[model samples]
Target: MALRVAAELRRGQVVNLGIGLPTLVANYTPPDAGVIFHSENGILGYGPHAAEGEEDLDLINARGEHVTLPPGGAVVSHTDAFAMVRSGRLDVAVLGALQVSEKGDLANWMTPEKGIGSPGGALDMAAGAKRLIVITEHTNGGAPKVLKECSYPLTAAGRVDLIVTDLAVMEVTGDGLLLKEVAPGWSVESVRGLTGAPLRVSDGLKEMDFTLPQHPPVNKVYPSAAEAVADVPDGAVMLMDGFGGLGGMPHYLMLALRDQGAKGLTVVSNTVGIARVSGFGTPPSPDLQAVDHSILVERGQIRKAIATFPVSPSPSRPSAFERAYRRGEVELEVVSQGTLAERLRAGGSGVAAFYTPTGVGTVVAEGKEVREFNGRQHLLEEAIRGDFAFVRAHKADTLGNLVYRGTSRNFNLVMAAAAAVTIAEVDEIVEPGVLDPEAIVTPGIHVRRVVQRPAVFSPFQPIKPIEDNGRG
Candidate 1:
């Protein structure tokens, strides 16, 4: 029989689909479904399942499954990804449920036993989507999945809108579960009997209207490169991913935020740039002056900066810099970049802490708790979380799935997986499903939103272009 549920999806709809059963809809969508698929990691514009022999090793879905890219697909960072979701940009999010309440609450992430890997960003998406459709097996190990109320840990208070199961498709109403369509070969009595929850039906109940008109999306575009920065919020922390200017600092945004009087930013990066390594008037340029973010950071604009190398290397870069360190001008926390990144990753993913051997010796072991494993000392690294992460990307789709083009992929992907919101800047946007499944490094699941950004030419004036400077 034809799939009744697939008809519920309309074209041009941005849909956030949970793992497993909900993913099947990607395959069943009509060629003209006009549906814009979203993966939580930050990919939008998803296409059909991947074809054999054409898999791009870099591409994969939220579940780490291979997928096809649709036409006009793009990749974005976690910041932009979550921004879309949190901003109420998605049309629908189809989720798989462990238990659903009559009130429409859902519990699909953690179970008493180990099942799925992690909830990832399902909770965020569930709470953010304009519409939520649940698709799941009718029962689990003989027990009905539907219940009068969810017994499992709740992800959101009350957000479910519809429940589609093998036995029937139901909508949540204030009165209770509104039975809409009974699956083929199933009678209303059979479905009612199967459900463990209190079920209700409208006297005027009828099969749901599944057919929807396909709407074409208006093409969206963005400037090549634009950066905007704001101060870390009160009671919030700031984090960055880089081993110094080896990866360029966030020059444009930092300046913007600085100008906005944004203060109390706690800067965290791999290391201080050349100023820390080279003395001023040194024969070779430390490559630090070219670093925009670091320059602003050194100007007392940043309240705190953390890195593996705390001491400025030359101890002699700028006369004032040496005096500042001696006088405690820039607060610093030294750590190995590896450990720091892992800590941030763990923190962002909700992991409490991880054990590593990178910083167990010498001064690195000062105040932190330490333990020995396999006859070697290890230090406990706590996780780090941030309100927003400014990450770079080559391309992103509307769904928020991100793909990095080159060295720029480094800390951006890790940061994408570790923030409340990630704003991704990319050079290009492609149709969904065009990226080879094997090529996707970051799945769309961790991503919340995406915006197409054009290419940026650097060293431009910060102020709006006044009278033409002939450089244009």
Candidate 2:
């Protein structure tokens, strides 16, 4: 079945193969065919499944299954990967379908009454791919899958172009289901009996061919957070994940970075640091409850900062970053939150620059080119890339596939894709196949190293006020 679909692919085409059987197309692709496989988890030009005993825990497809990489392959951030799909750069998208209507409506994300379904990248791919092809069995337990109208929720309307089932090949068109071919042993009459929708047999109908090919695995586990960040060098641009306060901050990695003693670093993140409680000033305490990038700032390791918030909300007690900026000890480039996200996404995705209206007509627009679109002014912002990105996650597999617990997922998802190397600090490390494929938020391919979060870091501890002795 996979070979039949692989035969349809052309040379030099960029394609996205969805989870499940659709991923098998990579293995069957002809060696001479210059096809590029893209995984929504943020990889392109990935090779077939790993050979036995060669699985790299840090390398896998979008489905969280281990895979190898082809020459010249690249990894990108989540937003950038979606940008590729939504920008119509993908030549074809082969996805598994639960049901495809005669009118070309697709329903593959979820079944009715099964709670809210995770759409993942299916919605964007359905609407963005230049061509969409579906692969699935002709029927589910003897029930027809090609239907008059999908009973399941639509992934995208009128988007399916072709479908390859166990028993037949069909093309979707405005006129309706056009039966193009049937399996070798199946006849038109047999196919019609299994189809819920009316069929239009093609004049050139023929038998579907069947042939198969072989393909091939890795695990990413580090003993400690310090060892995970040991390779990071001085004067590197580092991206830290966290929104406000310490909700999603990678404190362990930040601590490792501080202890690693890298100097002249440029930090990129949403905020400089959490506000200092009354007694938490001057010589910072390792037990300081609000530690974040501010710890780096206080240590004088940061030579510059690019962020949305670099000061404490209360002006009376400035953050370490604020004091550094006022002293001309560090450079600062403040950006809008949305713009910052897009910039990091763009940087990871091969996009040099883009225009957005978020920062127009303000200091954010200073020294940037402004263009008018739809009668509104927009500023051009270059993409922001990092030498390394430190992120936090709830759980991770030995292969580095990550699952976030809550708001901690925030920038961590995008930062994983935006860096040259991404080191994840996870609370727990499970074996491969333990985390559900659908639940894996950051795929292993985007991560270079995985470290277990330290036990000493307690989330519920209260920060004591800084001793007001003259240190203030």
lDDT of 1 by residue, 1-472 (tens): 1145577777656787778788887767786776778776666676776788888665667877777766556565566566567655577888888898888889988886665546688888888888988888888887888888787888776798988888788888888898877766677888888898777776766554456445675333333223333324533455554443434334444434445444456656555444324333132332323433444444445556666654456544443333455677656677777888787767555567888988677687788889889998888888776666666676766545567866767677667667665655555566655665446766554554444432453422233322322210
lDDT for position 26 in model 1:
70
Over 4 Å off in model 1, which ranges? 1-24, 27-46, 49-68, 71-145, 148-162, 166-194, 199-236, 273-289, 298-300, 318-330, 348-350, 361-372, 392-408, 425-472
Q: What Cα-based lDDT does every candidate model obtain?
A: 0.64, 0.80
Residue-level lDDT tens digits of model 2 in 246-297: 7788888887777777889998998886434223322254563566676677
Please list the Cα RMSD from the true structure of every candidate, rounded to 1 decimal place.
8.2, 14.3
Q: How high is the lDDT of residue 331 in model 2?
A: 96
Query: Which 10-residue window in model 1 sums to the lowest lDDT?
Result: 463-472
Model 2, 223: alpha-carbon shift in Å?
Answer: 0.5
lDDT of 1: 0.64
